[model samples]
Target: MNTREFKDMDLSAYFIGPKGENADIFKELTEKLINEHIGYRQNFNAEDANSISEFEKTTPEFTNAVTNMKETLNELSRKMRSGSIPWTTAGRYLAHMDNETLMPAILAYNYAILWNGNGVAWAGSPVSTLMEEEVGQDLAHLNGYNENGWGYVATDGTIANISALWMTRNVASIPFAVKAVCPELVSDKSDWELQNLSIKECLDLLDKTGDKKNEVKAQSARSGKNLQKLGKWLVPSTMHYSWQKALDITGIGEDNLVVLPVDEHYRVDTKKLEEIIQENADNHIPILGVVAVVGSTEEGAVDHVDKFVEIRDKFREQGVDFAIHVDAAYGGYGRTVYLDENNNFIPYKDLKDTFKEYDIFTENNQFLKEDVYNAYKAIGNTDSCTIDPHKVGYIPYNAGGLAIADTRMKDTLTYYAPYAFQEGVAVPASIGQFTLEGSKATGSAAAVWTVDRMIPLNISGYGRLIARTLFAARKFHDFFNGQKFEVNGKTIISYTVYDPDYNMIDWVYKEEGNNSLKSMNDLTQAFSAYTSSAKGGNLYNLDIITSDSNFSPATYGDAPVKFIESLGISGDEYYKEDKLQILRASTMSPWVYDEKSFNYWAPRIKKAIQGKLELISTNENIL
Candidate 1:
């Protein structure tokens, strides 16, 4: 695709419409979906007697019930319309990780629901099970996984994260299980060496056991023993809360989770991470795994996975190894921005020319920093990753994905259900055996499959959408950084928390010549609450809605010290109160990329802030 083609592409065609502009197109496709399913049912066993007669269809009781259903549906639609966030609108919604789902995904989900296919078992969903597998393969490919890798959809990112932890714990125990079941297989290796085996090494040992694989797994962590041998899991403070939940669920006690501090930019300080890993090794404590976040939930920071790979390799040379998993639920799809039409990763040197060819970025606004680019490129080298289709793939809900670098990882967590597979099948066409979830809706899988088919995951497709969001984020970041307001004779200046690594912008307001961190936190909190719908503020009165988050000394561990001090806040004041509040804006709406829309909304957003500041100055109780 060329720049002109990208510019001319009708992004509006992909949505039902912000104002019903594409309603006719959506209706036509929806009717086609219903008719196609009905036609298939009518064609099957045509010679057999009909289940329902014409008389039954015309019954007054049935007719009345159908009318009541339509009326109830109308009432529900009205309620939803009145209560839902206007996510599809460009300037109205800049909060959270959600956006308007792509039209293809929505329609495909609706179409598949009519059949009610269960993805857990091939017996329950012969057709959709295969489709789900294909969707998994597509995700694996999108994440740059090689041919030996595999992936599958989970309920959501939370489930995916838990599954990764569970797999890691079980795989960590395989060497112990092998030593017990087949002593000869590991007679030369000591317990310490076996405990330190890499994920691949453990799987290789399991393969050598062949028929005894089951016996070995019976003694593994999944069987509820040898868990302590798995040692500690390392994660940055910016990690999602799901990691904590994963620890609780996997029986890897929360105390076993080592929380590393983030650097000034909110990325895991790799130097500190290395020191901790080395300390663990020197202390003879076994290590389970390390999680690197591709996009932190609060700050949109990208941890350096490339640095992680280098550290892992350096340790592996000294007989130390640990699995590396990337939690990319929010930024995985952004990898498309670095890929070519053929899905090959575009080298950093060539990216400038490519951007020029696509007319996507301004000369001064190359959003792909060297660290972020290298982090994304290193995804394929990791053990596994959690990618949410709902977050960045623009797919509907209930479509989170887990991509494994090696397909053998599946065996570590596999379980067989007697009733879910066929007797003669060599490899059962089902996902239940290898997943954390059972009886999942295949409609979510269909939604992913449909979107991947209609819009490729490469630069020509998803990349286009991602590029627009990045552009919008950069513009917003520049706009806010340059903005200032005078209210009640106090000059207020805005500063971004950090230059965005992705599409989210975290910013705060500080009063001129004011060094109090508490006052700054108060002002930002009041501004956020004034513009928020959840704070009992009227949405219609605001020009934009944004989310709010806090950073505290307890949770962030001195990470906010530099950011707080940058605003001239006294270090003593920060230590005294120890909290920083900021407003977060997620620029996932492509419409904000339009110059006219940006111009219209930017001024109004400033006016809203000025109004809030004026109101807060008058009401000391607002804080």
Candidate 2:
């Protein structure tokens, strides 16, 4: 994958069409799928009588049913076309964490659904189950995991996070279980020490049980008996809401979750985290794990994962440890930016040279800042991570993934469902037994597998696509920084909430002399109607489509305080209103970086903002 070869590649071939440009390509592929399905049916028992006889084909009842189905499908398609968001159009859709899915993924999903295979077990979906395994390995490798690691697809990142928490909870109890079941295995450790053993040490103790592993596992927290011994879980305030649900569902009450405040950049405060860990250790309070977010949902902040690894190692020297899990649902695939064609991580010093060689980031290298690069590099050292294919992998919905650094961690969450697997089948044949979901759809697996096969998960593949989005976000941030709008002789200033760590940029606006946070929130909220697809407004009357979010002291603690002051709002006003509103743009589309697209849309966006400001000035309720 040389720069010339990558530049020469046709990016349009990967997308169906913005306006049916690739309709013929899609039609041809669909015909092939239909023909293959017909061949499969014809090859099986060709001599047998037809399931639907020729006489039935002529019946008016059947004819009416087919006609009714066609009419219903047409009606549904009409409604969808009118109501749905135009996510496929790169220029219009800047909202949310969605964009155009890859053509191979769409086609593969359609092809796989003809069989409706269930990925729960090999007995039910032999071919697709194996494909799921391969997809797992692909994701594992994409996130810096090697042969010793193992991964699997889940329903979504919520499920993946919950499963990781479940595994951590159960694994944490293993040392205590071993102490009770086989005293000699953990004889050198006291009860207090057993409760505080690191995740790896606990897994090692389980391995020591060998023949009695199942019995020891039964005595662990999975049996719902030792839940109290599993200790507290720590996560940043920037963590996804799913972490709360994960804690709640896994029997680790939300009260036990310690939410650390983020720094000015919205990243977790490592100093506070270290202090908490040291305090917990001194008090003998067992700590189960710490979650680091690679891409947070609200601000798209990348936590200092490298700092986390260093903290863990620092405490490990003092005989204190906990598991580290990364919630990278939105930014996991960005790791490809640092990987070569062979999937090896590029050294930090050579990263610029590599990008130059690949003809990417040639104009601006700030997209790969030192902090962001090191954070991605440290992901391999974490115990586990949650990644979503639909978010960053450019695949269709219902595909989330989990990767564990060690394959042996699978033993902690294993179950037995006799009907799902055959007696002689081996490990992966019984994958359902180790998963949180049952009867998972093979379409998602097939879609992911197809995309990975067509587009490798390395620098030459996903890296190129992701790099463009990074550049787009940086440009958007730069475009809005210090921009001003004049209305009614009052100056309205525009500011990005923070420098983007990935592709999401949050923009805020406030009158130059106005220090009222509520007024700012109202103005920004009013402006959102223009850029959003809200009902009661003209859907097409927009310069761009963007999402909106709120930051407040309640959920984020003091994270918004500094940002609020920078916007000329006082701390008293911030606390009084309790919220700050901003427009969010997720520039996941690669086309946004093109010079023509940028030049065309950027001014329109500015015009739209100016129009909103003039409208607000005339409206008495807004000021």
Candidate 3:
């Protein structure tokens, strides 16, 4: 108690609940956790009708993903209470399925309609494929794609990103196809022609030319009549390492990815992006596309989607054929309901009302200056994008998603069944075609459908709930901004302010405002990420609780929007940030609402940070 230099952490009662048997304690607890914690879920607030009450009546039969896993854990907990089943290996004693930690996944299994096939088709349970289609639709709509279109929900963001890269490569070939082919005519013997004729053949023609970049360039102008055009993709430096991974995955050289620097806010530097495009093309590399972010994991920053779109259009006039892919895997669900419904984000010029249109009414429903912010749905206007329901969507784990803005882009990523095999198929992008993945997550599809059913994708509902989390983020940010804690910590960016050009908070050192505030954040985070007994959770991301309302994403959507808008994002370009390690107080859990529960559980986090800091501050035996 004497060494507790960080005073802003008054969460003394948090880890332990108030001493009472009242059921109200639990309800209050859920609210505080929902609004205050910032770890998981679509958000603290419910965003729609279905969202409000997906499970109104929990069967003593367990509802939560973690709860289901704990059914076995509870048995062990009971055994532990009885001193029977001792802690064995955090180990092989459990299997992936029968393992004690399979609860949340099991919860998802029940909803999946239990399809075990590669999930490759209609025969695998027509219902299952139907659900997948619905899940894809939800993802597309949530990430700002057409509401009723074709997209895919896959195993992970890696696969999703890879798929987009595949589409990107195919589309890039369309404009460059002619120029890339003819130079290989010398090597275009019978064996080579038979082995490769399709785009893969053209790409392999890369090896045929042996000239590397020039062969690819010659392929661009195969007829040798004109200079070829191959463009670079401008991406935020804060983007996922996956963008680089895609370069390798699609045979696109790493050198072709034009990385743009970020401003203090972690958004792509617009001026730099324009400069890189013009510079690279001048150096003989046409800019291929722009891949903005919806939710970057490193800093949880949603890039300004609207701004990038403007840049995309301006560059396209030069015949740049710019494709935008939004990496929103961690933040796709930020805008659940469609409050800014008019889709004002399009045409790129009407982003001015972004703050007011998505603003949430505070205490008296009266709008506050602090209450205005940008929207996420408005920020992800990409040719394609990917999102994960497992992370922020509040669904159980493993339900990552991929959504493409242009419906036809799906065709570019597809594999034609030799025209002979798929002779009768109407759609070129069949379930099993085009994708790098073979078997997919059926349970994930079910989970997405079930959750979306609970929370309709309109703004008056789930969108409102999304807004609430923004409120919590701002509350947490404001709380730390003014307080001069004893520890040294820094600002961690999360949420979009809704303004196409503004809204993201910078995470690196901000020396101008307050010097003491920086040290406190540093001190707080130092201890927060430490491990005691060398066991338990680590503070890996900046933690902030939106409010109990954010936890209600499972309930009807109403209030999450205001909070979301305040973070300042739009549907065109996602704000991205570095993967700075920090503690995240997740309100995605419904356990953090009222004063009573706040008294019990909140303090543990504070204590944990303090205790870890103390451990680090002392050399012990060395001292």
Candidate 4:
């Protein structure tokens, strides 16, 4: 786990990736777009794609959308690089990106390897590559990871969560699996020994659960090395759906996954989680790693890390074994700036007072911040965690991260070579190596470094920036809550500081006659978009946006754009069902400062809502 043992940790030396071996792949992609984007665009391809047929034929959207998306992306990239984009831009997708290094990072990454697939490792991403251990160590140190841990960088939060889960299932179950099916080999006859296995392992041994025999056979089939261990993984019901996805990949039935309930604040009910762990403990239902969330997706809910550590301690005291995986994708980076009413990290006790002002929402969700985020003051123990620079760190899109508390977990899951294992990798930088992913990109690492330059991952810097966003959230909450709008039912601008986990001041304007997801989505979208539109009325658009998409038709088409839209939310959307359009606000931009930003934008949002009401009231036939 020490740097000397992992001496070759630097991946920047020879070549970024597979290119050290083969370089042509890099040439082809660059050649495809070379001489394309050196300066500001004076001209653009006419919107008419039919005129130029070839460009429209193969991956038609690839050329058109790719060009458009990249153009806008590059613009935003330049602003982010310069710290010139207003805080308003942070919550919305705009022409301005985070930083210019984003381009160099991508170009260098693409220069390093030609990846058109999954990004699991060097073997899979020969063209993409492994990063230097030394650099990764720096990342570890930044996140306050334990001194001697080794880890891999995943493509996104979902992948990172899956990787952590897989590691959890494997390390916890493998040894138990070996013992379960061959129980006769053991000399120990104590009842406590049997309880040490997974529910599946213990069931396989007892033929106990309803379908005992079938369970045994299924587990036996899954035991062929690939799935030697899997049973119940204790995670919050509030966990990301990806945990279910990980279940499918591991061949462990999702039915076996235990979802511990969440508290009023939407945090995992750590107490309930422990009861289940203790209940199953003596029964041999091995409690796999306990996955806690530092920043949950639904409400920005943060699982109490300190409480989780306490659970870890109690479980260990009970002689039970499990790892703790912290899903801090949304909130991890905030750990550094978790200050007192003032800011400081050295005297770091639970300085929960700094968050006192935000706690007003906990009563009626009428305030800016809440007590929940303050709970962050208590964090300590962790096994592994997910951190995304793309999120709170404000790096450009597609940059997520993972940091494990226990560096030893890397050793538990590492792949080695038959001959001398290189100090860095026993794995190679070509396809079909030891990875669940296929291709890779080093651009992410470069971007991580670039943004860290702008905002350090310590308590003072990054935490301060994130705190501003929360202030913006609270400001928007107050503005929306106090204002009068035309919705029939109670107009709830839900940035109920009660849940600091929530990003948008979800103004659930239930139109008097209809408040279904579809109706709500339509109305809310209209309210947010029109208010946020630069062309709307008096508002300058300031590049700030925050609004969510409706999931009512219960389909997935607009979920992603809807989520992205909420970031600095507001934009046009092509609704497939009714072909209706509406405006909305995402209210997550820090540019929503005191006098200048809010004064200009809030009135515009109100006016937009009024205009929409007039439309709804006038169109009785449509309703």
Highest TM-score scorer: 2
Judged by lDDT relative to the true structure, which candidate is superior, 1 or 2?
A: 1
Worst 10 residues of 4 by lDDT: 5-14
Show where candidate 4 strays beyond 4 Å: 1-135, 177-230, 339-380, 416-435, 486-497, 502-504, 510-590, 593-596, 619-623
lDDT of candidate 3 at residue 338, scale 0 to 100: 33
lDDT agreement of model 1 with the native: 0.84
Root-mean-square deviation per candidate: 2.5, 2.2, 15.9, 13.3
- TM-score for each model: 0.95, 0.96, 0.60, 0.61
**Tens digits of per-residue lDDT for model 2, 425-501:** 66554567778998888899999998887667877778888887898888888988889888888888888999999
Error of 3 at 83 (Å): 18
- Writing each residue's lDDT as its tens digit, candidate 4 over 1-623 gives 32231112221221223112324544554665444432213235544344546745577566787789889999998766554333323223211112222233345444333333344445444333444233355445545564655444456778878777765555444344434555553336443443244322432343332333333333442354434233477777657788889877876668777877776455677777778887887676766667877766545667777777777677767666666777777677666555432223434233344333333122232432334444454443466677766666555456666666555444334444433234355454322122344344565654565444434455334544555555556666566553555444334332122324534333444344342435545555554544344223433333333334332212223333443244233323324343223222333344443445557766765665565555554543223
Clashing pairs in 1: none
Q: How close is candidate 4 to the true structure, as a TM-score?
A: 0.61
User: What is the descending TM-score order?
Assistant: 2, 1, 4, 3
lDDT of 3 by residue, 13-75 (tens): 222222222335445644554444333344535463444354654645446655778798878
Candidate 1 local Cα displacement, residue 441, angstroms: 1.0
Off by over 4 Å in 1: 1-9, 47-60, 363-365, 422-424, 536-542, 594-597, 615-623
Could you tell which candidate, 3 or 4, scores higher by lDDT? 4
Model 1 residue 81 distance off true place after TM-score fit, in angstroms: 2.2
For model 2, the local distance difference test gives 0.84
- Please say which candidate is ahead in TM-score: 1 or 2: 2
